[model samples]
Target: MAMRFSENADRMDVRYVAGLARIALSDAEAARLQGQLDDILAFVGELKKLDVSGVEVTDVATEAQNAWRADVPIAGLEREATLANAPLARHGQFVVPKVIE
Candidate 1:
């Protein structure tokens, strides 16, 4: 169900929202939070009254294109040179401890 807020209507129920969130709020805390939430909803109500017919919808703020480079194959390090610093090497490959039975 959609929840709406307006000056003429009853303010949002903080206790209901708290219950949905699985939170336990004391009466005093619920009252305080209710006032804060009401103010936020009122601000949103004000924003809904604004006219933005001339504004353009945009996905990004900047005009820059994708910064990715083309993928290409290149020569890699020699196996012998790479295994030189290995603690264990076998059959031109690094040997690691067995992790599973």
Candidate 2:
């Protein structure tokens, strides 16, 4: 858990996070956000008063980690055998549309 960022997460942090999330908060929004963040920090502080001494941590998911076989190098399919299933190929690679364009 991060301590209160009020001392460090200034307008710069809010702005940087907003930029990464593609948000465009106005002056009022940023000011409101600062207050909201402060309240959230205070609430988190309140939770620290709990006594969870014997609590056992748990995995929240039903899925289990897949255990693999021994580390011996297994033979893989040949390049032509694998590429045979691709819808289209160029230079022995899958030819998807250029995403950045």
* Tens-place lDDT digits, model 1, residues 1-101: 23653456646777777877768999899889999988987877786678978889789989999988879979999998999999999999899888589
Report the C-alpha lDDT of model 2 over 1-101, residue by residue, as the tens digit: 21333444432345555766768889899788867866877677676688878887687665667767887898898889888989888897887767586
TM-scores, each model vs. reference:
0.42, 0.41
- Work out candidate 2's RMSD over C-alphas: 8.7
Instruction: Name the lDDT of candidate 2.
Output: 0.69
The whole-model lDDT of each prediction reads 0.81, 0.69
lDDT of 1 at 85: 97
Q: Give, for candidate 1, the lowest lDDT window spanning 10 residues.
A: 1-10
How many pairs of residues collide in model 1? 0
lDDT at 47 for candidate 2? 61
Candidate 1 positional error at 89, Å:
38
